[model samples]
Target: MKEILVLYYSHRGSVRALAEQIAHGIHQVPGAVARVRTVPRVSTVCEAVADDIPAEGPPYVEERDLAECIGLALGSPTRFGNMAAPMKYFLDGLAGAWVNGTLVGKPACVFTSTASLHGGQESTLLSMMLPLMHHGMLIAGLPYTEPALNETRSGGTPYGASHVAGQEGSAALSADEIALAQAQGRLLAGYALKLAVAR
Candidate 1:
């Protein structure tokens, strides 16, 4: 099977939910599979350390995951109009991959969740794209052709799939949000298949 890595960081489960939906979409395409992974949270205190295995949810991603995956779906909750620190930290540590061009020519998509309607989802998505771009990956966004891009009132955008998780971060994924994420997964997987065939 061709695997697409769904890498994400979630504080309140909102971004994780979107990641699952995106994985579901990837599985819709024949010969495509989703490999869900999460990043460990960073501590401000200098002495803190994360366990090798997480207590719950997906385990932290490894370099092997990046090397093996055919495509990538990166997600994170918005942190003041940017990706959360843990996600950024993980990406920053990938200089070796960048130097080796491990991700070059691969397809990638970004997703995010925000605490409010204007919580900088687009900017967060843009920030996530920067690292992927540096890795020489092809960035994919939701096109107008997807009805959810025009119809979603909660959390879908041309930049990528997003969620309005409310002030307390209590919002659940709306139907439209789920559909759009799934659509993006399918689109990305299809593109990966074509790229594989081209080679």
Candidate 2:
């Protein structure tokens, strides 16, 4: 079976919600499976640490996950128009993988959530792509043909799947957002399976 890593960080559970939908789509493709993982939160105070394993949710990701996966789906909540500090911190620690080209030619996509409709989902997605590009992964995105991209009023984007969590962070993901995310995952898994077979 070909495994696609679904890695993410979620604060209010919005990004994790999207990640699960993406994983569900990945499983829709024959011979493809999703390996869900999450990163730990960063601490502001010096020397602060999180448990090696999260209390609930997926375990913290490791470099081995990147090496073993056929493709990647990265997610994080938007933080000031960029990926959250925890996700960025995790990526920054991947210089060894970048140098070794471990992710080269792999298909990768990004997803994000924000508090408002105008809360920089596209920019956050773009920002997350930069490190993957450096690691030589091929960036995958939602095409306009995925009708949900055109119909979404809340948070779908050409860059990737997204969600607007509202001011109090209570807004559920719109149906269009869910559809687009699933479509992106299926497309990525299909492409990865094709490449694996070709190899």
Q: For this target, which candidate reaches the highest lDDT against the unseen true structure?
A: 1
- Candidate 2, lDDT over the whole model: 0.92
Error of 2 at 189 (Å): 0.2
Q: How many backbone clashes does candidate 1 have?
A: 0
Cα deviation of 196, candidate 1, in Å: 1.9
Superposed Cα deviation of residue 37, candidate 2 (Å) = 0.4
TM-score of 2: 0.96
TM-score of each: 0.96, 0.96
Per-model lDDT: 0.92, 0.92
Clashing pairs in 1: none
